[model samples]
Target: MSIGRTDLNLLKVFEAVYEEHNLLLAGKRLHLTQSAVSHALRRLRELVGDELFMRTGKGMVPTGRATAMAPALRDALRRIEDSLGVEPFSPDSSRRRFVIAANDHVTAVIVAPLSRDLQQAAPGIDLVIRPSTRLDLAEQIDLGRIDLAIGIFSQIPPRLNSRTLMSQGESILMRKGHPAARRKLTLRDLTKYPLVTLSVGGQEEGAVGGFIVERGLARQSEMFDRRALEEALRESKQEPRSRVTVPHSLAIPALLRDTQMLAIVPASLAVALAKSGDLVRRAPPYKAGTETLRAVWHGRDAHDAGHAWLLERVAAAARAAEEALG
Candidate 1:
């Protein structure tokens, strides 16, 4: 179907219906009467040559065809809206909520400061922090469900625009007054203690494990393999040493305090904890893989004023974090 011939309003009705899953709620969201919504749906059904949606006990359920077209329709509307500049960007006036995908590690290391700056600079802006995962990032951005994604993404889709925010390595952390804190940590010292490692983006072995392998202190292994190592260490030693696994980098400090455990975490996190005097940070004995945190968005948002504002703020925040760590 030709783009110009299609009724754009129909897509809006479809999107509201799909999201609300109830014609009444969808009509309310669109500021339309139930009859008007039904008329729009009927037109859409005729154009698409399908029922589009069916009334169910749960709500209005989209047909498979309608579900498939939703993302593209959403993208089309977003592109048109952005091109027309329908919503003029005024940080102080615009009260639009932006959803950002990032993990707690990124939040602890960066967003705290970024959010503070945003509050002072753009009081009308609302921000939602969502979990950062590899699933559907590009698709979500395209559909305008997520405005930006920050952190290390293993893969980048061709249609997205991205800029590297910062590069970092990992560090080893131990609690104050712990036996391992008295001496510079070697691989043997690390192996002797139970470990608490941060798992970011499913990478558990992380930089310290890579560094250990690079230094010939240990063999290269996956995070699962490292977990096995921890299990063997626990079973082989007469005294049971405890090993704990956590997801966020910020949690490492609390986990290490008054415990004989050590953690490998992002350098930014380690530095933050060290400045607080709650933990001591040391370099890993071997070379671990480095990570490049990047800010990514859809190409359609490349020239959007609000999106541009967000990018500038994020880049500024990244620089501030790097300088503070330095």
Candidate 2:
């Protein structure tokens, strides 16, 4: 059947159910009763000739065909919403919740200041911080699962828009009385200690660990390798020592206290920790090029007033955080 053969309202119900997975929740979101929602789903099934969703133990599960229709349906709905201007976004008056995907370290540095500013400006605004996996950024942004993402992103899908907020180099972090705290961190010194490095799964090529490799200071090491470095007492010519494995940058400061562990982190974060007396920041022994922290959003939201406002605030907060660190 042609697209004209099906009712658009049925597609809306189908899309909501596909996203929420629970009929009751989907119905509540669409302001429809359970029976009405089910009827819409049935109509959709008739039009598509597929059992779009099957009952699962906890909620409905989409069939393969239903899963494939999700993105197109979502995109169409977004376009329709934009065209109708049915609900113009009013940040000061609307109770819209915005979801931002970012790493823990970025959240620690940006969220607090941004939250305070937003609350004072628009008390009704709700902010949700979600964990970001590198692999899901493009998909999440495209599917409207995440409104914006902020971090040192290297791989931005061609369809997305991004702007650099600030650039940062790598630095070493050590606790206040540690031997390395008073000295510069050379490659040899770094290799000598038990290191703690931040890692995120599915990061882009030439991001994160690649910084060290690009500098010729150290080769790319996995989390397990970092752990082996920590356990080895003496370094051998054949087997390189392992360092401590940390997945998030914010954890570095707490781990360095009263231990010989040293961590490499973004200069901005290192400076922030140093100012709080949580850690001492030192230049890395070798030259690691700077990475720019960027604010990214789907191109569809480029002209959106709320999205634009949030981007501006994020940029301002990043600059403030950098200045505070300095």
Candidate 3:
């Protein structure tokens, strides 16, 4: 296949169809008819000597060849658009949709406030949240499906770029009127009361250096530093009665609403969750060092105006969240 003989428009159609997964929608996006989109796809497939895509009831599924072509193709298109001067992004006037990846806690702590801020400043913009803990997170970012990922990412691939949001230590959260709510959280208290914590993954799932491995990508899974907590426990010679471990941080409020179960969570998240006035936050006796919250995205989008604008807003939100934590 000669690259020079291929129609560049087919690549555009491919990108739109790959993203929308429907020829009609892709055609509408490209301002072409359904038949025209089909024709271009066929020509491109024949030239490249690959089926490229397969039609399914759900939509058009890209073949392995197309999947392999997509990330680089989209990146090239972004570069081309940037070189040709893409339209200026006006959040207030533009109806752009930003897909951000965040964990449930970050969504509540940071993204929730961001939505309210957007309501007044960029009313026309839309936000889509993706779970940052998903196995294919990096792949999704590379495919341009997720514009930004907000969380504690300790290992960022070379292809990706990251910006730190805030650094936070662990805090103990317990319901009001709890046995320990009246006093500072101590290792002895952790040993006495049944503890609840969040764990996305553990050593069984191949975590090293406080990160969990999934789909070849290492992500910070354990919300707090286990080694530090264990070290503190050993130094104090206390065995914590850790009973309930949950996957979602949002469940902590209900879990601790009336019971004596205490949770060790990120201070920033503790601040957000404590807004209900039922949860009390206190410094833990153990020395769990600070964890940096960050936003990660494909390096290709680092310079895109819209993405840059979203980054600015997310940074501001992080700042606001940090301030609120204090």
Among the numbered candidates, top lDDT falls to 3
Return the lDDT, model 1, position 272: 74
State the lDDT of candidate 3 residue by residue for 1-326, as single tens digits. Answer: 66776677788899888877899978876779999999999988888889998999999998989899998998887787789886677888876668899989899888998999999989988898988877778789878888898888767778888899988888999998998888777788888898888887667767677687554456788887678878888888878888888879999899987788989898988988887898899998877888899898888987788889989999998999888877
Q: For each candidate, what is the lDDT? A: 0.72, 0.71, 0.85
State model 2's lDDT.
Answer: 0.71
lDDT for each residue of candidate 2 in 87-181, tens digit (9 for 90 to 100): 67776776555789877777877877899988888788778888764554556666666888776654565677888888767677888898877
Highest-TM-score candidate: 3
- Please list the residue runs of candidate 1 whose C-alpha ends up more than 4 Å from where it truly belongs after superposition: 1-66, 134-139, 200-242
Model 3's C-alpha root-mean-square deviation from the true structure amounts to 2.4
Ranking by lDDT: 3, 1, 2
In Å, residue 139's CA in model 2 sits off its true spot by: 3.6
